[model samples]
Structures are given as structure tokens and as C-alpha cells.
Target: MITLSRRHLIGMGAGALAASAVVGALPASAGVKGYVQSTIARMSLPEKVGQLMVQEVYGVDPTVDDSRNLSKYGTAKGVDVVRDLHLGGVIYFAWTNTYDNGPDGVAAASNALQEASLETRPKGRPDRPVGTKVAVPLLIATDQEQGIVTRFGPPATQFPGSMALGAGRSTKDARTAAAITGKELRAVGINVDFAPDADVNVNPDNPVIGVRSFSSRPDLVADMVAAQVVGYQIDGKVCASAKHFPGHGDTATDSHYGLPEITHTPEEWKALDAPPFEAAIRAGVDMIMTAHLLVPALDPSGDPASVSRPILTGVLRDQLGFDGVIVTDALDMAGVRQKYGDAEVAVRAMEAGVDLLLMSPAPLAARDAVLEAVRTGRLTEAQLDEKVARVLTMKYRRGIVERPLCEPALVDRIVGIPQHLEAADEVTDRTVTLVSNDGTLPVDVTDRRVLVCGWGATTTTAVADALARLGATTTRQTSNAPTAAQITAAVTAARSSDLVVVLTNNVATSASQVNLVKALTGSGTPVVTVAVRNPYDVAYYEANAELCTYSYSPVIAGAVARVITGRVNPQGRLPVDVPKPGGGVYLSFGDGLSY
Candidate 1:
């Protein structure tokens, strides 16, 4: 008889796991599939349906209800919701006040939820004298994508966003960053991360997915996506979810407020949008979150991909051969809720073959709808069992079943340690992209006055502080939309300073910021412009020297400072094309410079 430790099984990766199953090298109970089957057979219909739901709740403590959550999401006390609804998972958001108390608080809250999920319960009647513990454990999840989308604040290592990694063009860096992120998440008991966005980001004007996506090139995105999948799930410590399936990259719309439609032909999709998702599937990603957009090439049913059988079942499952869990994006978003009510959307999503219903606005109503559908023949009990089994299988495969609780005391020790912070800084240093230089870079700050001015006080202050630490005298001016007085003041300051460094946030769309850059550049003081949010802003205006950091995190600001001061060479290349003012490409993808 062959025996494999849980550690060995998790490290085996998805391909190895399947191969092991084919050879019958382990007992049925030791294999995830067999354990999931036996667990499903013992579950009631209500319990089975509950296993398909993952809700978002408010509060740092599971036993207490936050009034804000009740007012905003209408969620009850965290422990009660998990116990009463028998939820298979829970998602935490910073806005929901879940991270208000920091890492230890998060770990404690996660332990409470897990305790609730593992509690014994009556088999049928609430008044029963004897009861049994819940069969499956909860999958605690969060969007700790880092960069601009981070949920955890300081004391947690903040890595650069996806585009920054894309600019660095190192799969090793991508994997290392994800591994650090996974370690921190597992330390706090979050087992699932909705991250490493797989969208190709072909549209420069894309509202939602710009820097969140790795790159515009499908091949590059595919490589980075696969690397991150392995990184997050390497030891089965956390499950990685490659999101916005069938692609949400080329749309000009934001799915949170409205529906976005993609006009890719079948050939176009196979070439552009399908590569990263295909790569993710081959990498054995734990989940693929569906996009709420309509892709007519894949599904002509007029329903969004989240509820389209042709796309979810036909394209993703049949053609793509993805046998893992399929999760829907937040059902409360306007993208998926445009036509259907809460109840109907829940039923239709299950019909379309999604395994998990994430963050439904009305949890009880959604669960009741699924139960009714199963009873009334709209959805078969067998279908419900299949979905629940997938969820259970993932729980076991990811080691959540055996280790549901986290140690709060160790959270501080394991999260944001020195080595992880150093890795983040090294990655950030490599992502500073110098797009243009006219012999003004590596500023001689020794005895020179430098003025740092721009939008976003946090970003400006960070840059100024970094410069000050290097023994340069610096002045700062911050305004989101500079007024005439602010512009005049900044220009006056620029004239007196030996050099001026101006930071811009989407200058292409903000005429005021463009005017600020124009006024400072016109001062003839040798200005260096930094594009903080998107690198495409540099095309709108002229600067003596320009660089793109892709994000405005303090770490990125420090990296930008070092690049300008010649302490670090700018090594990052553009991940997407930057359009010129007249509509052609000013800076194509892969454009960068070094001193």
C-alpha cells in the first residue's frame, strides 16, 4: 500500500493528482473525490444547496452584527449567518470593516466563522436531542490582489499590481509575489484569493481592468497567469481564482454599474481572450469567476456569460475541459442584475452551471430560490449534488477540511515579515518604466532645490519624502484638479527650483492636470513627469523626462524616486500600447529605457 502525506498530496499539483487517481495508488477515503462523494451522500438537500453559497458579511467579530452591514448588505451576525444558512464560504472586504483591526483581528474572525461551520447541528428538527457536526468546512476568501485593489492595509506586505509585474516581464517574480501573498492570506485563514486577473487588457480605455490585467499580449498574460496559479496553489495553502472568464478586457464599460458587451468572433476569442483562461485551466486553478458581459460569439442566447449555458457549460466546460468549480461574480452588481430579479438570477446562474453563488444581495432569497428550483424540477437534485460535490472536493483538496482554523498569535509573526517586504520592494524597483529622457535624468540633488507637485496628496507626499531622505531639499503641491491659483503657485515654485518633478493621474482625461503639466513644463526648469495610475497619460503632454509606475502605492513612489535619482535603473517595459494625441500609437508595448 502506498501512503501520501497531506503535504505531499497538496504539493503534487493538479496534473499529478489526476495521474495518481488513475493508478489507484491511494485508498478511496484518502482521495479527494471519494471523500467528497461520501460527504455529499450524507448531506440534506438544504445543506447541499447551502454548500453552493458564499456570502459577504460585515464585522470583525463573527458573533456580533455590525449595524453598517445590516444597513448596507442586510447581513446578520457573521456566526449566525454561517450557522443558519450553512454557508460553504464567506468573502471579506475592507469596506465591510472586516480588516479594521488588522491581521490578528482577521485571523480571529476567520477562526470564529470556521468554528460556526464546524459546529454540531440537528439532522432534521431543531429540537432533536442528538446532533452531528457539519460535514464540510467553510472556504474563507478575499480579494487581496495587492496594488490598488488591496484589502489589508499596513503591517501586510503590499506588492505591486499585475501590470507592474507584467512590465517586469519575469515569471519568477510573478510566482514569488503570489507565493508571498498566499502565505500572508493563509496566515490569516483566507483560503481563496480572487486574483491574478486573466483579462488580456487589449483595450487601453478599459475602465475596470487596466493595471489589474498582466498585459495586452495573450501569450504573456497566459504565461503570467499560469505562473501565479502555481504560486498561490503550490502547497495547496490557498486556492487561486482566475477571474472574468471568457474575457472582460476589451470593453469600455464598467460591470459594477452597467453591463459590458464584447464583440469578439469565435476566431477572435480563441486568439485574444481565451488563452489566459485556457492556461489557467491547464494549471489547475481552483475557480474561474464568470464575466457578466455578453459574448455573442460564444453564446447567442442574449443572456450574460454568467447565466448562459452555451458559454459556461458549452464553451468553458465542453470545449475548454474545465472540471473545477465555476463561481459567479457578485450577483448584486448591475452587470448581472440588469434583467433578472435576485431570486431568478440565482436560479438561472445554477442552471447555467455555476458551482458557487458569490455575494448575492439577498442571501436567503437566493438560497430559497435554488431550493425551490431543485424541488420544482427547474434544476435537478443531481445537478445540485454535483455542484455541492465540487465545492466539497475543493475544500478537501485545498486542506480546508482538515485545517479550518487559524492561529491568531502567529498571524503577526508570519505576515509582512522582513523578507516578504524585501521581495516586494525588489519587484517594485524593477517595474519603474522610463519612457523618455533628454539628458535630465539621475538628477544631481546635492545642493539643488526640487519641487514635487501633483494630484493625490498621498502620492505626492510619498515621493517628496523619498526625495527628502536622499538629502534633497523638496517642496510639494497637491491638487486633484488644480485651480488657477494652484497652477500659478506650482509654476512659480518650479521657476525657483533647480528641477521640478510632477506626478500625473490620468492626464489624458483630466484637462486640468494636463494644463498643470503644461504650465510646469513651460517653466523651462527641466521637469520629470511621473504617470502614477496609467502609463498612457504620458502621450497627452510633453515632459523633459517621463516614467510610468503603473500604481501610486508608497512602495511604487519610492521606486519612482530611486529611478529619477539614478539610484536604480528603470527596467520596466510597457504592458499596453499608449495612444498618441492624434490616435496612433505614441509608445507601443515593450517600450522602456535605462540609464
Candidate 2:
């Protein structure tokens, strides 16, 4: 299994040129190949290494500029280093994305970043004409895998989560939601969405990806993944990464906390986990985001798939034939960061065959590590050339070279517009799943006394608004965590009212939520429970009627109320299976009973 490094041919240019067919294993686009090759030819070793590292947007201030020392670039502020470090991209986390994150602020930041990304100092850099603009664009990427994983928003209309879309079961709706998602992202100059999770939610007890996945069935997940790939890539040209590949669905462990493993054999892997990824590739997905999953069946050494040669190179690149960009999940996660520094992770990840190093904590240090790896005869120059060329091809394919900057006025106008909200409402209306009922729903609000007890800020308001609008004599009580007195008050209110509507969250995480629901139902009044976050609540507490609305967005809440009042028939099916209280099957996958 030993292959010599191509470091011996550093000075030999034309003779050392690798096969064009194998250079980065690009898509069948010849022009992109030529552009990538030419781009690679002009870049320095430092620039090429820098292009592989993607950093978080912390300390990145595009507004700051410091003069170069004719031999080196000085000063800090990550955004200014776009040109200095020749960075590949910066991922927007919640902190930086929302720091002074007004529409105008985002536009200014984006403009500054693009400007720096396209221009460079005339210091210690060669192979470029004086004052010439760089043709490459940074991959402005973020995790807008909406419905739990959202980085930037408020001006963006909130769509129902992915599992909700699966329950809705319309590929068109899924695409439309992502179209809106993409357009809003592009409005703010984010050109890549690390989204449309391709994991099939087969485990009922799966923690991180319950409502995030489209469905428990592989076929349904494939459909939603393909649809979202089209939706994000089509209109705004924002690249979509069909994510957590080969699959992160069935694992009980959270990658954020510890490494999760999949012990299936190769045959079982293909049958259960690989379909969505296969479908995503077929759908022309621009990027595939790898998970930190350890598949002992694939790689016996127990390397996380992010750095597993068998998985990334053998399975993803060779077996599945995904020629587009391959990106690692955030390198800072506990799953992959076990005693590995930025330098070690960056070098090995590239060796494992990933194109992009996402969310490296010390990105500059990482760039230097790879640079040292190349110079010290550890990593080959040929590897750097191919990797950087692949990234350039991706930038070209995404049209970022031509149009890197976003329009500020258009951003304000297009993002979170009425049409987007309307479309979002339409999708949520379809995604509300009526789990079960004993004829307790459509709680007539016309002069009927109603008691509303809900969790969270938005959900409480939305439920109260819907009831008030429906002509119900409504009394509202809100608590994410209710005191004993508060619980008694809610029960007292429920007893006095004709019917009670309860909105709750996270029955699996908190037993207090289960207790809250039990107390509300104890009044023996006709009680309707809406699982505000996770749908597994019905397994713990019984309500006269139960519905699972994947999101508690104002629009989704309104839509939930409409469904309960029989305004819109609850059409969404259960995307994941819900286990029974005593530990057997309660609602199987695809179970949704409507009035």
C-alpha cells in the first residue's frame, strides 16, 4: 500500500504534468479543466495550500486593511487575509454571521470580502501581472441546513425542517423550499449551502438527526436530497452539499460529543446507507460533506470517515464516482479532533482525498502545516496542484469567478420577501403531520373556551394568536420550564376551559416536558398535544389528539393551528418511526392519520 510522493518532480513542469483525465477527477467539463489547470499553474505553493483550508469567520473583518512589507503581509483581521493567505473560503458560524448582522452589515462584509478575494498585494508573490485582479472567488459557505442547523436568518423565511418535507412527501415542495433557501442565501453573498442532509433516519432514538433528515426510508431521503440539490443549485447558483455522507442516520452517538460508528458490512452499507448519497451524486450535487463516522466494516483502523482513505477515496470517490468537490465536516468537532492538531488533520485529510478542509480553528497555522508538508517532502506537489485545481474548478462551475459580489439593495428586497414567506407558509401547511386522534381535534373556537399552554418564545405567541383569531375564548400560559405553581395554574386553566391545546418540545431530553403534558391531560379535558420540536413525545404522554409540527416558526405555528381547526387537512406523514411507551412500535414510518 505504499506510494512514493510526487515531490521529486517539483521543478519539472511540463514532463511532470499528470494525466488530464485524472487531475482532480473533474466533471466532464473540458473548459473547467483548462481553467483549473491554468489557475493551478499560476498559484504558489503557499497559495495552493491556503486554498485547501476553509476557516470560520471569527476575527474576520473585511473592513480592515494593512499594508504589506514587500516580503510579507501584516496585521490581523481574517477578512483582510483573504488576499494575504489566499484562503479558500470562510464558513459563517452563528457568532460571526450574526455579529453586527444586519442586512446592510452583511452586504458590506460580503463586498469587502469579494474585493479582498479578487485583489492581492504586490509583495513576495509571482506569476501575476501588476495590478491584475485574481480570477478565482472564495467559496462563501455556511450551514443553512434549515430546521435546527441555521447560521444566518430572520430576513430569511423559515421553511419546515427536512423530515417535515418528507412527511409532506412532495418533491416539488422540497425543491421550492430549497429554491427559496438558496435565493435568500445568495442575496447575502453566501454561495454554498452545507445542506440537504442525505442521511436516512432509520433509528428512532437517533439524537442529532431526527427531524433534520427527510425520512426513515432510504428512497424518500434520496428523493428529498436530490430535490434539494436541484433547488439550491438551480436559481441562485448556490452550491449544495448533500451531507453527512455515506450516512449518519442510525447512529445513537452525537458526533459533536463523541465518535459514532456504523458496523454494517459492505453489502448492508450499500443497501441501507448509500442510496441517498448515490441519488445526490446522480442529481448533480456540487459538493458532498463527509461525516465523522467510523465504519469498522470499511476501515479496520477506525479512522473517522472524514480522514478514512477507504471511505473517502475508495468508497466516495471510486465506488460511488462522485467527481464534484468533496468537503470534510467541521474539523473542530469532538468526533475527529481526538488529539489531532490543525496541521495533522489538514495534511491527512487531503491524503484521504477530501477537497475542502472546513472550519479549521487555526486556518493560518493549518496552511503553514500543509506548506511545510509540501516543502519537507511529506505531501507531494502533484497532490497540492490537483487539490487546488479541483477547488478552482468548483469556483468556476459555480460562476463565482464572474460574479462574486452580491447586490445590497437587491439583498434587502429579495431576502424574506412576501412571496418567500407565502411559499414557506404553503410548504408548512402541507408538512403538518396529524399523528393520531380520538375525535378531539377541530376544537371549535367560535365562542368555545380554550386554554393554551405552550413552550418557547415563538410557539407560545403563535398558538395564542391562532386561538384568538379563531374566535376562541382563549387563556394563554407559557413556559419552557414551568414551576410547580405554574403547572398547577395551567392545569386549573385547562379544567375551566372547554379544551386545552399544549405545545411542547424535547420529550426525550427532558422528563419535565412529559410531566407538564401529563399534568395538563390529568384534568380529563379534551387535550390536544403538538410536539413542537421532536415528535417522540407521544411515546411518553397521551393526548386526546396529537400532531407533530417540525418547526415552531410563526408561519408553521399558524399552519399547525389551521390543521387542528380543520382549516387545512393535516397531510404530513411521520418521516421517522415513533416507538411506543412500553418499547414496541407505535407509529411506523409513513404513519399519519388525518381527519
Candidate 3:
């Protein structure tokens, strides 16, 4: 056990943090829970219920997007909600929803929001009309999952996503990547990162969480999940969350669209799905995001995991012994929204043991519902206080109240620094896994005619650009769900080329990609298929050679090109098991081939 001073532990914002050697050695006062409990005791009922709501804010377009999110970072509406609603936090979406101003814009927006939250009684908390306004730092959270799910653009460091780290199989590298990510986020004025998708991708055809999950192996996933928690908490001081719990791995449906049911029994969940979350709790992950999926074995009520007390309080809290905040996946999703209205969903979610109501379609309605529930005895005051205290405890632990803003001046310098990019690139190179090969790779494009084709042509274009820089002749063709005629033309073009390299993305979601690749394979030319987003494309059809980059971004393309040209040997092993559509295993977990 590594023993450190109490000052060192608290400075890292990890005092009394679980599964830590240092925190266990500290005095009881070093823990933030004590401070938070006392603070909650002084709060009124409305103020306490207000601390449970977390809303979503957008940018640029007010009419098309959330009108309240009209502020690029914040407008009067942003301040209005903080003052009037007494909401706990706001989830920011940059490019995901509306056009957002880049780094400095985000910092300024965050600073404005924080300032509004910390303002005077009349300006800050409109609910508390009499007493002095107790300014609480709102939890500013976003999905910074790095690779395909990253919310930040340009100035933010583009770290390779979770599957990349899973391939490298280094706990130290996982910790380092998370630390770098956390530091960059802190600099940009963003604090909470919804990351490290702890779900094991046991099912390859899983549309939502394909490469986002680390691996299918429970032990390996558990190890990386723990390391990621430490990196975010001790190093980044950013609250890291393990999401879609009880696992979203095997389900074939996307929770954002509809409620997916887990077929696994309780024992199966304990053995396969629950380990990563268990490891995260032992390592002191600050938050856990509930999935909207339903598990019949856990709760026969047929409610999604987000509103099931047996799953949240019984399975997560009692069984896992996790006392951290329980955040629900966006309440606006069709899974819960289609069945229940926003207010009912919010009250039921609170009743089910969720600490924060995230991104409800009706934010004020949700807050009022919780208040009404407490007042009408639908939800006991003790129950309301339990959830609010957890939220307040996390705020204090994260030091959001003390230092909620970042210097906009340093946003440019601190974000996307060379060290962060270099580490990201290194991780990308390591995750480039060659699943199978017939000696068609290492295409010395030196004066060779190579046809690069794909659905998302950006990846193919990037590879072509890199090859052109290396003095190689290349042709590029891209489309969204190519027709049979388009596939025939691509095959004809490939037949005349020296080598054909096909890039595939989201083939699991779109079955048409399989047909296109099958058409190209019939051309009798040596075709190399690279699964850019979904790594399971190789299971359906046999390309001359198969590879996976797990992402189709800038940093990833360079690494893919290097591996094909033999500049670098791929060191990535498959993080998840590749199962065919029907039944058999296409490739077991930890399967990767080197050149």
C-alpha cells in the first residue's frame, strides 16, 4: 500500500475515496460527505428538491434546439433556470445538438453559468425569496468519451476512445490517457465526464455500444474500469461515471430509441456484466449512469433500469456497496418518454433511487413533480433528502463550489497540447488490430494503384491523403448506403486496381454494408476491409484481409495507413468477442493478429 500525507490525498480531491490505499489512511474530517451532510441539513424542501434536477443546454439555434439552451454558453435563460428552478446541474452539448462556438466559447459559457449559479439571493435562488441565497456550484457535465462520442471539437485533445485502451491492455496507459483527458477538460471549464462505458460488448451486433465498450472479458474490463476511475478522480479531479449499468452489452437495441430487455439471468449478470461496475465502485467512481434497458430478472415490474428500485438501490447500492450519485441516461429518450410523461418519469425515477434527473424534456415540470411528491407524501421528505444529499456531497467532493470557472485566456494553450496528442496517437497505433490477413496487407503504395472505398468517405479520404503524401497513387469513392449499381461500379474499379482497401462503418446498424462488401469480394481482386467504427464487419463476409481501427477520425486514419503499409505492426487485441448474426463466435475476446 502506498501511504501519502492527508494533504496530498485531499489535494487530489480523493479523501475517503474507496478502494484507495491513501484515502483509507486519512482522518474522517478529510472526507467531503460530512461537510455535505451538514450543508444539506440547513437547506429547505424546495432547495433540496432543486438539487436533484440536471437539465440539458444547447447552442446557436433556440427554436430548433432546446430554446432554454439558446445561450452559446449561457444567456439570460441559463441564469433564469438557476435562479428560478434551483436545479443542480446542466449538461452541455457542443456539436452533438447545435452548432457551437469552439473552445474559448465553451469556457466563457461555463464561466457565465457558474457566475449565475453563485450570484445573490434575488439573482441566484428565486425559490428561496427570504433567506440569503446560498450559491452552489452547478455540476457542468458532458459526454467526453473521446473517440466517436466526444462532445468537444478542434481545441480539445482527441484521445483514442475506450476500445483503443482495451486493445493496448495497459493499466498505466489507461490511467495516463484518462489523466490527460481530465486535465484538458478541467482547463476548458468542463468538469464532469460521462465516460469509460463500462458495459462489456459481448454482442458484436450491438448498435449503440460497439467500440465504446472496452472488451467482452469481464476481468480485463474490470481492471481497465478501475484504472480509468482513478485517472479521472485522482488525476483529472473530474467526476467519472460508469454507464448503462447492470450492463448494456448483449442487448441488440438502442435505449435512445426504445427500451431493450436483457435476457441474462441474475447469476449471468453477476458473472459477466456486473464485474466492471463492481471494480469501478471499489476504485471509487463518483457516478453511475443508469441504462433505460429492462431486466426482468432484476425487477419484474418491467420498468427500465433508470426507474427500478430493485436494480438501482438493491443491485447497485446494496449488492455493489456503491454510495455515489446515480445519474439516469437522458430522460427525453423514447424508452421512458414514450411510456410515461416527463413529470411522472421524474418522480418515479426519484422514487426508484436516482440521485439526478438528467435532461428531462420538462425540466421545471420534473422539479415541481418532485416537490409535489414530497409535499403530497408520494415521496417522503427523507427520500428527497437522501438523493439531494448525495448530489451535494459530490459537488463538495469535486470542489465545484470553490473553483467552478476556468481562465478563458488559457483555453487555447491548455487544450490539445502536444503531449496529449502524442499519447493519443500512440494509443491509436496500438489499437489497430489485424483480425485476419491473407498476406494482402503492407501494400507498398509506392507507385501502386490502390482504390480506397467506404460509407463514411472521410476515413478513406484521410488514408488517401496520407498515401499521397507518401507518393502513392490512390482513387477515392464514398457513399451513404451504396446501391447495387454503385457497388458494381466500385467492384469494376477495384478489378482494375493493384489493391482494394474498403473501409466500413456501422455495418451492424446498416445491413446494406455487408452486401456492398460481398459484391466487392466477388470481383476476385485482393480486397482489404477495415472496420472503422464497428469492428464486427469481418464476421459476415471474408475480405482478402481484415483490420479494425475502432474509430474513423484524424488520429486513427494515420495509424491505419501505417499498419497497411507496414510502417507499424498492429499491437491491438480484440476487446470484445465477435459473434456472427445467428450463433457461433466469429472471433473470441483478446484475438488480434500481427503482421
On lDDT, the candidate that comes out on top is 1
Each candidate's TM vs. the true structure? 0.93, 0.90, 0.88
- What would the per-residue lDDT of candidate 1 be over residues 382-474, giving only the tens digit for each residue? 999889888887877787776766656677788989998898889999988999999899886866788999878998999888888887899
Q: Report the lDDT tens digits of candidate 2 across residue range 295-329.
A: 98889887889988889999999999988889999
| Least well predicted 10-residue stretch by lDDT in candidate 2 | 15-24
Clashing pairs in 1: none
lDDT (Cα, tens digit) per residue for candidate 3, span 253-346:
9988988989999899999999999999999899999999989989988889999999999999998999999999999898877677888999
After superposing candidate 3, which stretches have Cα over 4 Å from the reference? 1-38, 60-76, 95-99, 122-131, 508-512, 518-525
Candidate 1: where are CA atoms >4 Å away? 1-29, 68-75, 123-133
By TM-score, the better pick of 1 and 2 is: 1
Q: What is the lDDT of candidate 2?
A: 0.77
TM-score of 1: 0.93
Candidate 3 local Cα displacement, residue 547, angstroms: 0.5
Note the residue pairs that clash in candidate 2.
Answer: none
Superposed Cα deviation of residue 553, candidate 1 (Å):
2.1
Top candidate, metric TM-score: 1
